[model samples]
Target: MRQLLKFELYKIYRQKSIYILFGVLMLIISLGLYMDRESEQANYLVYKQWEGEITADKLAYLDKEIIEIEKKMESGIETPQERLLYGISESFAYQLGNAHKHEKRIADLTAIINTDSTSYKERAAELEKNMLSKINMSKFYYDAGPAQIIDMIYTFGFVITAFLIIIGIAPILSNEYSSGMDQFLLSSKYGRSKAITSKIIASVIFTLSVITGWVALNTAVSVYTYGFHGWKAPLQSMFQHYFAPYPITLGEAYPIMISMHLLAALGFTLIVICVSAICKRGLLSLLVSGFIFGVPFAIDVVFEDLENIVWLNKLLKLSIYQCMKVKEQFVDFSTYNVFGFPVLYPVVTVLLSVITAIIFSYLTKWIMKRKQVTI
Candidate 1:
């Protein structure tokens, strides 16, 4: 088994296409980082001066400074220094304004729960619970880097991993059959079980490696751009997560988000392997796997405005796209009613991924065994 696994890993990693895809991915990431226009250094310095617990005294001082800056701007002579200060002031005010915005979000959800049909009442209640939990979020910190990294993981990272898996791992089993190696393999002593088992394990390792690679690159680039600050900042300090109900800091949420993404990607890799086994042709397997993986994203783009249609929207939320784009599961506060109790979307997504992996594992084994017998 160990020998077979080693050979499988070698075959996977030896492919030039894998390295090429990684090169492309890295180039795109570098381009994105280079093109970013924000003066993160200046922003960081300004935010650092006001970091920590946001208190009334700080707000008052900021209000006075903002008023003074506005008066300077109102005078027909404004210097670049004044403009920069004004921009910083407004940014701080906007960050603080998120508190009021979050409160309004909670009140809106509460009102919907009170007036909506009983069918949606449970979901609304869950949203209310989540919102209320973070209602007291008062701390502020320089979290721009962490926020960008988190957002990049859910958006670009998942897409990159999916394509890499398709280009690399999707051909694992199908190429064996295509090249007529299946006959010799099936006739070997350990081929029927150990060889195929090794392939499955190898697929998982490749998936995780791809995910880890992108995650590390994202973190390094973001940290280099924005500095290693805000690990202790509350998750809500990020504009994207202003409504997030979790009480954890960016340091805590980072692991949870990556873990969820890893599980989802593993589950997806298994399904792609299963398809590769069934199709018996490399290109066909790639096409089918891509379709299955991409359909959810297409649906989301088409029906984005129909989220008010609860059933359809909830069904879409269960798709792999939602699992891959995992940030929404945290920020949006969605839930599933299981056995008359509300289960958060993140929990449900994790459970679904695990279940998919288990089911597909057996199915892949069964398919391989049946194919061997026929051959």
Candidate 2:
């Protein structure tokens, strides 16, 4: 089993396309770093002065300073330092305003609960519970570094990882057929079980490596540029996720998102491997994998209003796009009604990813076992 796993890994390592794709990833990272060079340093220095627990006094000071800066700007005598200070103050004030929005959201949900509709009441109660978790956790910090990393991972980084997984693993099984090696493997006593398991394991390693590589490079550059100042900060500190319902800090959310991404990638790997086994042609497997992966993203993009339909929204939210870009799961208060219990979307996504991987692993094994040599 060990020998077979090593051999399978070696075959994946030998794929020149994998190396080329990795090179592309590195180049993109380099270009991104160059484009954003020193652009955020002033923010970092300014935020450092304000880092710590946010107080009413700090808020008042920011408001007063912002008004004064505006007056100076109106007079056409505002200096660059004052301009930077105004931007920083606005960022802080805007992020802090989400707390008021969150309060209003909770109150709206409460009003619904006051009414007499049981179904709407239950749903509103669940959503209120989710929103309440984030109530007092919002605090000010220099969170740009972690925010950029989280955004990058959930947005562009996962796209690259997905393509790498598809390009690398889609051919794992099909190549064996293309080279006429499937005959001996299927006819061997241990081939159906051990060899197939080893291939799956190798694909898992490859998927993990690809995720880790991109995450590490991205984080290294982001932290180096942004000064790694906000790991302990609340998720609400970032304007993009100011209303995020997760109670966890950025430090906690980062690993959870990565784990979610890994599980999603693993499920995707099994799917590509299954396609490879069934298609028995490397190029055909790649095309099929691309279609399977791209269709969900395209559908979600085309139908923005699907979120208004409860059932369609749930189904689409669980699609591969949501799985890979896991931030959407945490950015809002969404719940799934499971057997009269309310489960969070992140929990449901994790469960679905694991279930997909298990089911596909067995399905791929069954398909491989039923294969027969053809003339």
Per-model CA lDDT versus the true structure: 0.79, 0.81
Clashes per candidate (backbone, < 3 Å): 0, 0
What is the C-alpha lDDT profile of model 2 across 260-367, one tens digit per residue?
Answer: 988988998888888998987999999999998898778777887876787877777888767988878877777777766677888889999999999999999999
- Badly placed stretches (over 4 Å) of model 1 are 35-39, 71-88, 101-127, 134-136, 308-311, 373-375
lDDT of 2 at 26: 83
Clash count for candidate 2 is 0
Write down the TM-score for model 2: 0.91
lDDT of 1 by residue, 1-375 (tens): 999999999988998998998989889877876634357786667677767777788878877777777787788467665675666566566656866776676777777777877755647575565756555456667777887788887768888888888888888888988898887667768867777789989989988889888888888888888888888877776767766676678888888998998888888888998998888899999999999878877877787586788887777788877787787788856667776667777899999989988888889888887874333
Instruction: Supply candidate 1's per-residue lDDT for 372.
Output: 48
Q: Where in model 2 is the C-alpha error above 4 Å?
A: 35-42, 74-77, 114-120, 123-127, 130-134, 304-312, 373-375
Task: List pairs with backbone clashes in candidate 1.
Answer: none
What TM-score would every model get versus the actual structure?
Answer: 0.88, 0.91
